[model samples]
Target: MDFYLTALLQGLCFSGIALGIYISMKIFNIPDITTDGSYTLGGVVTAILLTRHLPGYVVLPAVLIAGGLSGAITGIIHTKLKINPLLAGILVMTALYSVNLTLMGRSNLPLIGTSSVFTFVQLVNNPNQNTFLILGLIVMAITLLIGYLLKTDFGIAMRATGNSESMVRSLGVNIDRMKIIGLALANALTAVSGYLITQFQGFTDINMGIGVVIIGLGSVIIAEVLIGWLNITSVWISLALVLAGAVIFQLVLAFTLNIGVDANLLKLATAVFVLLIVSLPRLLQVKD
Candidate 1:
């Protein structure tokens, strides 16, 4: 029960990255691999600030800014330099490796005895319950905010830019600017996950963000499956499903671990699981 509860908390913590991937891949149609680096950038910034005795609230904006900047660089490369989106993300992600290392000045940083967002307010005596409450509220708030934004005119243009870039460009919507902002927003959200996870786990490592994109992608794919099955069209419903996907994804992993799967083979298992999720639909279509 405790193991599943922990996985539930982790799923909530991961909501940010899941939403980020939804925006980047579903809304913008970009396979932004910058997720890996920007995520660590968030953790690095959060760790550095918290170790200096900075409050978690104060550290939040710094993480968002750092993540946004990294994403903006990738957007600029893709839009201004006319580079392929995948290549642009790769270039920025590669550069962020050095940037994260330089910012941390070390490979690993522990956050023991430091105040975190989860510790910011003690509504309940039980730590796990407190964390669950806080995370639930935060995830809901973010989902509502993003849902409202997607219904706005600016967001409509952004979505249109993704669906029909040439059409939006013909309407003088400045697709390049939209792409830049969209990617920045996506990465900023991804960074928030870094901020949450680093504090939750009590440490931040240089390699913490490695293969992180797969988790986000897997979560988003799960959401997509639900969306198709339910024929969901409302933005609110869609975003909520994404959050559910994140939780469900984590729970699945926890279940796998509980079943005595080797911890060392977890990544391989994750890859296979995600591959099955991604390929199953196509396989079904072929069968039909």
Candidate 2:
């Protein structure tokens, strides 16, 4: 039970990344790789501020700004510099490695006795349960906020810019600006996941964000599959499913571990599982 509970907490922690991926990949159709860097940047910033005895509220904005700037740089490179989106993201992500390392001054930074966002609020005696409640509320609030954003005019423009860039551009909407803001929003959300996960796990590592994009991709793909199957048209339902997919993905991983899959082989297993999820629909369609 505890194992599964931990997975659930992780899922909630990663909900932000899943949503960020959904926005960048599904809405923008740009496979922004900045997620890996921004994620660690968030953790690095959070750990630094938390160790100084800063409040969670103060750390939150700092994480957002740092992550947003990283993503915006990628966007600028792609839009103004005429670089491929993938390569722009790669450049920013690469540079972030040194930035994160320099900021941390080490490969690993422990938060053993430090206060964190989770510690700031004491809702219950049991730490794990308190974490669950806090995480759940945070996830819920973020989802609602994003859902509302998508319903606004600005959100519609963001979606339109992705769906029909040329058309939106013809309407005098600066598509480049849209892309920049969109990536900024996406990476900011990804950083939030980093912030939450670091606090929950009580540490931050320079390598923590490595290959993190796969988790976001897996969650988004799972949500996409369900959206297609149900022919869902509602934005709120789709967003909710994306969050659900994050939890479901984590739970599946936990179950795999529980079933005695070798821990060392977990990454391989994750790749294979994601591949299966990605291909199953196409294979079924071909059969049909």
Candidate 3:
């Protein structure tokens, strides 16, 4: 039970990244790779500020700004300088390694005695339970915000830009600007994931975000599969499923570990699971 609970907490921690990927990949069709770096950037910023006894509220905005800046840089390169989106994201993600290391002044920082966002939620004696509550609220707020944004005129334009760039541009919308803003929002949410994870886990490591994009991709794919099967058309329900998808992904992983899979092979197993998720629909369609 505890094991599953931990995975649930982890899923909530990663819910933001899943949503970030949804925006950039699902909505905008931009394969932004800045998620890896921006994730670590959030953790690094959170750890440094928490160590300074700063409030969680104060630390959060800083992480968001940092992540937004990283995404915006990729956007500028892709839109203005004509660099490929993938390469621009790669460049920014690469540079963020040094930035994160410099911020931490080391490869990892432990928050053994530090007070975090969960510190205030004293209703639960179990720390993990507290984490669940805190992260739950955060993810809920973000989901609603994203849903609201998608319903707005500008949000509809953004979606149009993603679906048919030429058509949106013909409508007098600045496609490049939309791309930039979209990427910025995507990465900012990714950073929020990092922030919550760092606080929950009580530490920040430089490599904590390595290959994290795969995890986000897996969660979104899970949501996609469910949304299709259920024919869920409500924006709010769709967003909620995305969050549930994150939890389900983590729960699946935890169940695998509990079944006596070797810890060292976890990444390989994760890759296999993601690949299956990616290919199953096609395989089933072919069967038809």
Candidate 4:
């Protein structure tokens, strides 16, 4: 029970990355592979800064900005250089590998003696208080802010660009600007997730982002499945579903582990779970 609770909390905390993936894949119709690199970039930047005695609040925004800039570069390359979106994301993600290495000043950074947002949360000294509670609050705040932003005029333009680039351009919306902003916002959320994860896990590794994009996609797919593929009428509900899906996914993982599954096989399990969920609707339609 304790183990399941811990996994649930961790899943909820990491759901921000899933929401970011939702925006790129579902909303913008973009396969953003840059999330893999940006996740590590956020962890590296946050860990390095925290180790250097920087405050968590300040480092948090810096990590977000760094991730946003990385995404913006990918958008620019795709929009201006006429590179394919997938290829552009690949290039940016590849570049971020080295950038993350430089940010950490090595292949990995240890947070053994460092202070993080989690540490501050623990300072309350309440036995019942935990990092998950603090992270949940942070995620909720971000979700609300993003929901509000998506209702604004610029947000509508961005959404229109995703729905039909040509139509949005005909309507005098700057498609390039919309794409850049969307990508930046997506990666920024991803970075923040990475930062929080690093603090929760107590270490940062360059290779930690391996298969992260797949996990994000899996989470989004699972969320959509749980919500019955409903058109996201309310932004809050959409975001909430993302988080709920992540928690459910983690619970599945926990169940596998409890059943004597090899830890090394977890990725395979995740892949299979994602595939099953993604294909469920199609299978159901055929059955009907």
Q: Largest lDDT belongs to which candidate? A: 2
How good is model 1 by TM-score?
A: 0.98
Higher TM-score: candidate 2 or 3? 2
Error of 2 at 107 (Å): 0.8
lDDT per residue as tens, model 2, 1-288:
999999999999999899999999999999999999999999999999988888777999999999999989999999999999999999999999999999999998888778876778999989999999999999999999999999999999999999999899998999999999999999999999999999999999999999999999999999999999999999999999999999999999999999999999999989998999999899999999
Task: Give the residue spans of candidate 1 off by over 4 A.
Answer: none
Query: lDDT of candidate 3?
Result: 0.92
**Residue by residue across 1-288, what tens digits does model 4's lDDT show?**
877877787687668789889888887899999999998988998888988888867898898899899889988998899999899999999999988887777888889888778667564565225666687788889888888888888777777778899998998888888888889989998988788888878899999988888768878988787677686677678778888888888889899888899999999998888889999999999999
**Candidate 1 displacement at residue 252 in angstroms:** 0.8
Quote each prediction's TM-score.
0.98, 0.98, 0.97, 0.95
Q: What C-alpha RMSD separates each model from the true structure?
A: 1.0, 0.8, 1.1, 1.6
Q: Write one digit per residue (lDDT tens) for candidate 3, span 1-288.
A: 999999998999999999999999988998989999999999999999989989877999999999999899999999999999999999999999999999999999998778878887675887777777778788889998999999999999999998999999999999999999999999999999999999888899999989999988999999999898899888788888888888998999999999999999999999999999889889989999
Residue 184's C-alpha lDDT in candidate 3?
95
For model 3, what is the alpha-carbon lDDT of residue 59? 96
Angstrom error of the Cα, residue 154, model 3: value is 1.1
lDDT per model, in order?
Answer: 0.92, 0.94, 0.92, 0.85
Q: After superposition, how far is residue 275 of candidate 4 from its true place, in Å?
A: 0.3
For this target, which candidate reaches the highest TM-score against the unseen true structure?
2
Better of 1 and 4 by lDDT: 1
- Any residue pairs clashing in model 4, and if so which? none
lDDT measured at residue 80 in model 2 versus the true structure, 0 to 100: 100
